[model samples]
Target: MDQFTINLLFVGASFAIYIGIAIWARAGSTSEFYAAGRGVHPVTNGMATAADWMSAASFLSMAGLIAFVGYDNSAYLMGWTGGYVLLALLLAPYLRKFGKFTVSEFIGDRFYSPTARLVAVICLIICSVTYVIGQMTGVGVAFGRFLEVDNTTGLLIGAVIVFAYAVFGGMKGVTYTQVAQYIVLILAYTIPAIFISLQLTGNPIPGLGLFGTDLASGEPLLQKLDQIVTELGFNQYTAHDGDTLNLVLFTLSLMIGTAGLPHVIMRFFTVPRVADARWSAGWALVFIALLYLTAPAVGAMARLNITQQFWPNGTDAQAVSLEQIETDPAYDWMATWQQTGMLGWEDLNGDGLIQYYNDASPDMQERAAAEGWEGNELNNFNRDILVLANPEIANLPSWVIGLIAAGGLAAALSTAAGLLLAISSAVSHDLMKGQLTPNISEKGELLSARIAMAVAIAVATWLGLNPPGFAAQTVALAFGLAASSIFPVLMMGIFTKVNNKGAVAGMLAGLLLTLLYIFLHKGWFFIPGTNSFTDAEPLLFGIKSTSFGAVGALVNFAVAFAVSKTTTPIPARIEDLVESVRIPRGAGAAAADH
Candidate 1:
């Protein structure tokens, strides 16, 4: 079959499975809609959580970021995975024992303040909405590539699919759908890596192949990669080149953000017991690690493959000629991707040969002067395209390429649905029922949830068309907001007897400060041309806006402690609530709420 037909068949098949699961597990009540009736198995919830957590950022863009930046980008890997440790240890079990349907609900009840709940709801919406933008953008990119449509159209189609499952089936449908998505995405990701690993290092395991010997050069894969990249005027692949302080802070921000993200935290609420929540987190990490461990290998090998493709003779040899790029079947992938405008090349200096090297490197400048080259020809290679194009670069089978198309869509759509659910629940459950319309019926709340989800999807789709960065970077901003505003409050609420006044003050302080810092660098309200400064030179102690979340979180803790000390202590009842959440013994009884 043709590539388009194969892509359609695979993607359509995966969507069919998701829709089927949604139908079979359609949610009937508010409890089911919000928390999957609190009946999900630990293993099933783990798989669903893995699929929900591993969004386009993890599945599509992370490896690509690592491919270009090398060791400096290891922050994403360490930060994301390490955060799960915090979740499993510090948050999941306690939150699950609290027996609430949403993170904001827990925060509101724990603080014993409607104002506190309102603050939590606002924070949840901000982070969740920011997050969904990345997912929508990922959906656009995936659908655009596979269906041969524009990004706008792809995003709309993806939004519709997400709406059908999320609005109709709610948490129950989303859970089962995510389980299936996890399977499709994992198989699709690993299959290409296995093929490429065998071709490059004669090793079937991509993770092992990354450190194993390269069959071509009889040297370690990383060593060979280092040599090739440096010879092409790029930094060595294994060296750390970014600011040390920024790297540490960025990683910490991602970790805190991971623990604080409402959608991820909500997954724990779906389990049957506190013990199940703990075990579910462990299983989620196991599933996440499968991809995380293999990602660096995918990045390293794909980098090596692309470099070799450009300089088939060697870096010291002449670069690939434009004539060959246009005519060679081996180079057809470039033409295919170029149609998306995410990949491009130009015969700069009218040399006709594609000098795909780092023009910023001094050594490359000297070489370019000698060779009559003006600048780098590979000027528009979007990092987001790396994984999606990897199978094609390695000449993998058509079926495998089609599988990747499905996988990318699954990754994007699964996370989108999860984020939409979080947003909807925050609106329908936390904001409306908990505060605004406390008397709203269950049927009314369900209808509101569906409406809220649709609105969120629309907003996300609109923002995605004008995204601020690649999928992962944009998502990192959401993580920053969550880490700053939500994580500190949640942690304090569970671990201490902080009063409502303190919680409210801390959340607002963190949320406002983080938003201001991000806007100063990224743009006012993230509108394209409104920024006064760039992240390249942030105003705050040389820390980039994206890395400022850790500082904001610390600010939150300090403010909360100071504010609480001067104000009233936690009430006796609230204190008892706090003490009760610390133990997991009553979890089975808690599950009876549904």
Candidate 2:
């Protein structure tokens, strides 16, 4: 089959599977819609959580970041996964034991204040919406490239599909669909890496091949990559040159953000018991590691492939000819990806050839002057396409190309559906029924939940059509919000005797300060032309937006402690509540009582 036909078939078949699961496991009650009735098996919940956590940011953008930036980008790898360690140890089990449907519910009950819950709900809405926009954008990109449509059309189609499953099926439906998504995505990611690894290093395991010696060069894969990249004016593949304090803080932010995210936290609540929640987290990590371990390999290998393609005779030689580029099947991935308008090239010097070397290279400067070259001309190569295009670059079979298209869509759609579910439940269950209309019937609540989901999908779709930023950029905001606001409040509720007044004050301080700093850099609500500092030279001690989340989180912890020490302590009964969450035994049947 042709690559397009194969992609269509695989992507269509996967969508069919997801819709089928939604139909088979349709939700019936508010509990089912919000928490899958708290009956999901640990293994199944683990798979579902993995699908929810590994959104387009992890699947599509991560490798690309690593590919272009070299080893300094390893912060993303360690930050995202290491956060789950905090989740598994300090947060997941206790939150599961709290037995609540939403993060706001816990905040409301723990502080005995409706105002606290309302603030948390606002924070959750902001974080989830920001996060979902990135997924929607990812869905559009994945669909546009494989389906041969414009990004707007692709986004509309994906939004309709998300609305169909999420509005009709709720969490029960989303859970089973995610399990299938996890399978398709993991297979899609690994198959290409394994093939590329074998081709480059004669190793079948991509993860192991990353550290193995290159068969062609008789040098370690990373060592070879380091040499070439440094030779081209890029940093070494294993070198770390960014600010060390910021790197550590940034990693910690992502970790705390992962633990605090409501969508991920709610997955733990769906499992049957506290121990199940713990094991489910471990299983989630294992599933996530399947992609995480392969990502660095894909990034490093793709960098090598693209570099070697440009400098066929090494960096000292002339650029590759346009005739060679057009005729070479190895370059076919470029043509395929260009249909989406995301990857482009131009021969700036009119030499009928494209030069892709770093123009800033001191050696390249003299060579370019001698060779009558202007500057690097292969511009606008979107980082998000690297992982998706890897199979094609390797000249893999058409089926693998199709599988990757399906996998990218699966990764994007699965997380989009999960985030929509969180948004809907927060609106209907936490905001509407819990506070606005307490007397509403279960059936009425279910109806409102589905309606809320539809509205959320529509908003996400519109944002996707004109995405404010890339997936990684948008998700960074979401993490910053969660790390600053939700994480600290939840930690204090479990570990300390912070009163309602203290918790409320801490959350507001954290949320406002983080939002202000982010807005100062990213523009108010991410709109253009309203920023005070460029992202390249941000304020707050020169901390970049990506590094601000950890600082915001620390601000949260500090404020919460200072406020709690001066105010009235937690009541005796609230201390008992804290102790109750710490224990694991008899936590299989959690009570809603505070």
Best model number under lDDT = 1
Question: Each candidate's TM vs. the true structure?
Answer: 0.99, 0.98
Badly placed stretches (over 4 Å) of model 2 are 591-594
How many residue pairs collide in each prediction? 0, 1
1-594 per-residue lDDT for model 1 (tens digits) = 899999999999999999999999998998999999899999999999999999999999999999999999999999999999999999999999999889988888899898899999999999998998899999999999989999999999998999899999999999999999999999999999999999999999999999999999999999999999999789999998889999999999999999999999999999988989999999999999999999999999999999998998999998899999899888889999999999999887887798899999999999999989899999999999999999999999899999999999999999999999999999999888988899999999999999999898889889888888889989999999999999999999989888999999999999899999999998998888899889888897899999999999998999989999999998899988999899888887866754
- Judge candidate 1 against the unseen true structure and give its global Cα lDDT, from 0 to 1: 0.93
- Stretches of candidate 1 off by over 4 Å are none
Tell me the lDDT of model 1 at 212. Answer: 98
Worst 10 residues of 2 by lDDT: 585-594
The 10-residue segment with the lowest total lDDT in model 1: 585-594
